[model samples]
Target: MQETIDLAAGPQHPNQFALLRQRRFAPFFWTQFAGAANDNLFKFAFTVMVTYQLSVGWLPPKMAGLVIGALFILPFLLFSATSGQLTDKWDKTRMFRFVKNLEIGIMLLAAWGFYAANVPVLLGCTFLMGLHSTLFGPVKFAYLPQVLRSSELTGGNGMVEMGTFVAILLGNVAGGLLVAVPEIGHLQVAIACVALAVVGRVVAQFIPSAPATDPGLVVNWNPVTETWRNLRLAHGNLVVFRSLLGISWMWFFGAVFLSQFPSFAKEVLHGDEQVASLLLVVFSIGIGTGSLLCEVLSRRHVEIGLVPLGAIGMSVFAIDLYFASRGLPPADGLHLLAFVSQPAHWRVIADLALLSLFAGLYSVPMYALIQMRSQPTHRARIIAANNILNALFMIASSVIAGALLGAGASIPQIFLCVGIANAVVAGYIFLLVPEYLLRFVAWMVSHIVYRFKVRGDEHIPVEGAAILACNHVSFVDAVLLMAASPRPIVFLMDHRIFRVPVLGWLFRLAKAIPIAPRAEDPVAYEAAFAAAAKVLQDGNLLGIFPEGGITRDGTLQPFKGGIMKILETAPVPVVPMALTNLWGSYFSRVEQGGAMVRPFRRGVFNRVGLNVGAAMTVAETTPEALRARVDTLLRART
Candidate 1:
């Protein structure tokens, strides 16, 4: 066993790159990075060899890419469930070493296959490499949450995502260049692949021990049964399951563009092979940029609000690409320089890069959310299930795009249709899980409507049941609070607020607990308390405006007894919070009329803040005491 906490020699800043300096993260990061690079390098080299050099009748040049891709993904479909279970049942550091050792052995075999110029042997190596990746996926994802704090999830995931794409990009470029060498291209590729494998194994030895999440678990070797079991485990949590589907949908969406890039560049852009590679480089850079931005945009927390924003950007840019690519003139095999020199090609390049960038922003948060929220014991298996879905979605995307192209739809038209369809599919997913939409709205309000900030946010609980008692200054106070907390906070609101048009619809969408005065509606009041208690019992945060309603004046209202009544049922820690600089805003009653009467009363990006205070234990939680704590926060500047 090893220490669960990651300790470093010196104090580290909050920057994501600071992780590279620590023992706990650096070695594993490099190990995985080497593996990713080696996989792409080997696959691309084999692909070039098959398509341009070899002439086996059964594997034609046209079908070689598809066949190789299918062979690579097949292992994920067959072994991912078992691999996830294995990940949970063994030390993760041991798993990394085992996978790297397997890679080295596989690469040795691959060197012989390349030297002998045996197509079957090379194909077998591809499947084996795929298996290597299938095993590495779950452990790589599951290891992060075990070592990093909740506050670090966004930044940590961002770094990994960025590094993976960059590795893949570098690998592809190296393979293309190395395999094109005059006489010793094949030999050079073999040596490079073997060397990369050796490097991965060397780095794997340094990863700190991450003890088994489920050491006592029994092994289930049957992929069929275990795959089903793994998926069912994921489905056990509605949010996690839906998130799995959402991420798979992203893969599906991106696959269409990635698969079509070669065709699009040659046919639509009238560019050479080099131009296609240029497009790939641009797209990879965009993804890396979007991924690295998540930590900064989210303030180093797992903020799913970026998911919807990313989805919207993906569609917007993809559609713009359709219009940009339409009515382009044919050119005579233009290379990278000539292609970019033509101003007409710039929009197509920009669109491709932006869509891929949005894809990065869209995916990192969901991945981190799954990592943070899934049961530690079952997290790897759920991630394995996610891999299964991603592979299936990618396959579906390829088949559908191929069929559409075969049916004579132009590449731009297919892109247009997918862009339109992305909006609908994403909208449907949001409907099923309203949390994404709620967070999106809150994210917009905080990012666009005001320069939102949080202080003492560390007081917010990461796990288990807790009650958030806050001084509600304005209608948007709940939104601000949602923006600040790393995890979702379900609020208990006055029932009357739910009838206020757009605000009401939003509250209902959030699944807020709607309470009324006990005298006016006793049944509804009791039902609200019961619902609130159930939320805590289920180990979820339940938020309340301890004043019972938003304040009309910029003063602290007395805490109501409803909070005390609910506390008697489930006496969890009470976190006091406050919102400042919002009372005179448009959402408040400062003007003669209420919200929407005036826009940006204080101007966009107004200075607004949420202040969280130390949590109060049940024994010290009184109406007066809670009010005083919240009052102190309300008066204190964040």
Candidate 2:
């Protein structure tokens, strides 16, 4: 059984670096880092061998690359569901130990394959490695949320993402360089793989134990049925399922770009292995930097707003990459330095780097969201379903790229096509879930239009249900609160506000509860309270402007009874929040007769403050008391 944890207890680590200093996170970090590096190291070495040194009478270079890709991806399709079930049924830390040990054995087989120059054995090892990864994938992600506090999820995921890409960069460079070292290339790769495997195992041994999320879950061995079951579970939740699609699409986008790099470098730029490695380095570094930046940009929240921003950047930069590389002079055997010497090539590299940076922005939050939203009992299985989809998407990308290229389309054309497709897909997704776009707008308004400073935000619970009572000072009060919050909040607003044009659409998209005055519509007023109660029962944050509506004056209005009624029904902790310095803002009804109502009346970058007070118990949460607490917080400068 899962132990009850206090969701109100904030994160132990303020940043990713603090997480690295803790044993609970560090060991698992290094273990996964080693595993990612080893996987790429072996895979890159094998690809180079097939493309350059191997002379298989049966398999051409292209066929070999295709076979290798298929071999690695096959395990995900075949075993992800089963792996998910196993992770849920068994102890995760013990499973990690076993998986790491399995890696060592796989590396040993790889060594023999390299030593004997056996094509079949090398391919078999690739398949085995894929299986190893499939088994570990669910555990790797699920383990983090279990160990880290809710507030740390974003930062922890950022560290993992950054580490994975850095590992990939190192692996690709080392593997490519080693494979080109004449006769002893295979031996060098074999040694490195084995050494990395052993180090990974040692690190795994130090990983703190994390109990299984669902110890009573029965293992389902049938991959076909289990895969369907897991997918259905994911689909049951619209947000989680859409997040899965978003993550899979990112993989599809990345696969198309990364898989084509070597060929693009050779055929388009007419560059050698070093140039390919340089491309990998630039892209990988961008991803790492962006991943780390998510923590800072989000202020430790799992901000999905970054997803749309990432999608837009990816499309724009990808299209630019096509244009930048469209008419480059092809110089055969051009090295990294030579490629960089040209000014146009720098544009190409810049595009690649920017695309990758957006990819990091695109992916990390989705991962954190999935972890945060999914039912804990089945989180691992949900992740497995995600892996399955990711593999399928990547495989589909290769097939699509091959078909497009086979039809005489240039690499730049493929890039352009993919970029256009990304924009279309992103539009469809944003339409389906307007909250993503809404949040993006809220984030932008908070950061760009109004400079927001928050204090005592930790007073809001990270996970459990809580009621937030705040003074309503402006029309955008809820948007500002949502922007400041680390978790998604359901706001209770006046029904009239829900009828406003674009803002109403966003309010509805955010699932805000619309309340009417009791004198106007008793039924809707009662329904609103019921909705607020349900939100609390469902373990979500619900925000209410206890003043009933935006203040007509610049000062606090009398507290309404609706908050007491909602609290009486839900009996959850009430967190008092204050929004300050917005009485004269554009969104505020500050001037008499509303004559001064206009956008940017205070100009761009108006200063605003949000002060969150400690949560009060239901017994101490009368409207009068809560109002006093909020007033106190409002009076203090944030």
Candidate 3:
């Protein structure tokens, strides 16, 4: 077995959706899709049966609904902690196989319950299904980060989420139709569920066994305590924790609107069950469309800009949903298909789709961000926190909806109120976490106007620490490097240059390390060396331009000793890279032979290139040898 991680270096995953096509990832995705379908199909069947078919002599409507919900969610609340530990301790493929087998058994129980017409047995089956889901949850999320390239995380998660939600919509619709089949009997629904389970099992069989990252992980069976502990791990990083919370809040917002849909259709739009179901279809399509569109809008990168955009769209449509229902009378049990053709009902459809679309845009990035930022060892635990919070938030949404209804508000009114609340929630989250907005700005600026094209990126190591040697191309080189390279790059620069009026502030804000040449400022130079060593020790990439200043002749300058000093201390790998064509770009100085620097001189839309060379071992690196190698590499690329 390879003890070290395999690195797929530079411009990897050209097709952002390649994760979906990989053997390891395809099985995992189908497993999730199958699980989501099963969950929704079972829930919809139970809800429709209890609401429309059951003779509720003893149970109240709300009480019956609550009991059904409890049966479905309780297992997640109870077994999720243990499942999370299992995902960490065992080989994920074997564990995933076990869960798929468990699903087949649960589906058999469901069949038995349906045939016996036993509500208690059916409810018990629901709990077992939830248990299966809870176990699969951690493995589902944690496994993605292991297989996908860093650049592919957002697109991969987007596709997965899109598939999951779309499956849910199909499952719900299919279950309703299946249960109504004549002569075929209720066994049809049971067979369908079993068939989906069989498909899921087949997919699980193809999954490559992912080795455990934390094989020594201890099992934490106590749900209450373990849940809190998992939450603490998620909370360890402010950005990651907040992103997780944002995801939960979105669920909270979604649950509120979804729970009241039937009422909204009947009381507000004057339609029947079919119309309410149509509203669900609209929302599902909207969300799935928005989720899939994320890859396009973001250019397969994580662009938090859309988060704010989605929030705005959600609020706008939600408020419109309220106004559209104004002056409308309650339905006198009219069938939805007949009523939906009326011109007045289009507003509801528009509202439902827009709300779901924005929600899709809003939620996908948070998942991507969490996957990108969280530590590998604890990623699954954090996703477990997400699952726990999703459940809690959904529960709270029900409570909130109940409270609003009890206070005598109409369904349309509740939607309008929540839409307004969504706007407020979004604004608050963005304000509290400005990084999302900032990253969007940076990402767009680089990808759009500059059209950065990196060449020879394979030279960078896939893992471990490395010091990057580059020919300074422009003021934005560090940010460009940060964006181009999958790993974060810490740059060392001249203190005076870093302190330059406006550009200096930008560099400081980006956290670039500043150093003065030893003859000019010995203290700062020593500090730079120390800082570079610390960064390498922490397993981060450090970028330094050997030219020490922009080239006057647009040709290579001899490398300085800083590279030698850093390598002596850190002794990791030294990867040489070159930036060409950017010298004539907007951020570049561009003046030849003592000419003063110009600002935005060439304007945007300039072509730029970054060429990276393979890692140089410490033993082979002396100042002369390193400089010669870098010069040769840069010249060859240019």
**In TM-score terms, which candidate is top?**
1
Candidate 2 residue-pair clash tally: 0
Per-candidate TM-scores read 0.98, 0.95, 0.83
lDDT value, residue 403 of candidate 2: 98
Best by the lDDT measure: 1
lDDT score for residue 557 of model 2: 92
311 Cα displacement, candidate 1 (Å): 0.6
> What is each predicted model's overall lDDT from 0 to 1?
0.90, 0.89, 0.77
Query: Against the correct fold, how does model 2 do in TM-score?
Result: 0.95
Per-model clash counts, in order, read 0, 0, 1
Tens digits of per-residue lDDT for model 1, 32-131: 8999999999999999999998889999999999999999999999999999999999999889999999999999999988888899999999999999
Candidate 2 colliding pairs: none
Residue pairs with colliding backbones in model 3 are 459-613
Q: Which runs of model 1 end up more than 4 angstroms from their true locations?
A: 1-12, 591-593
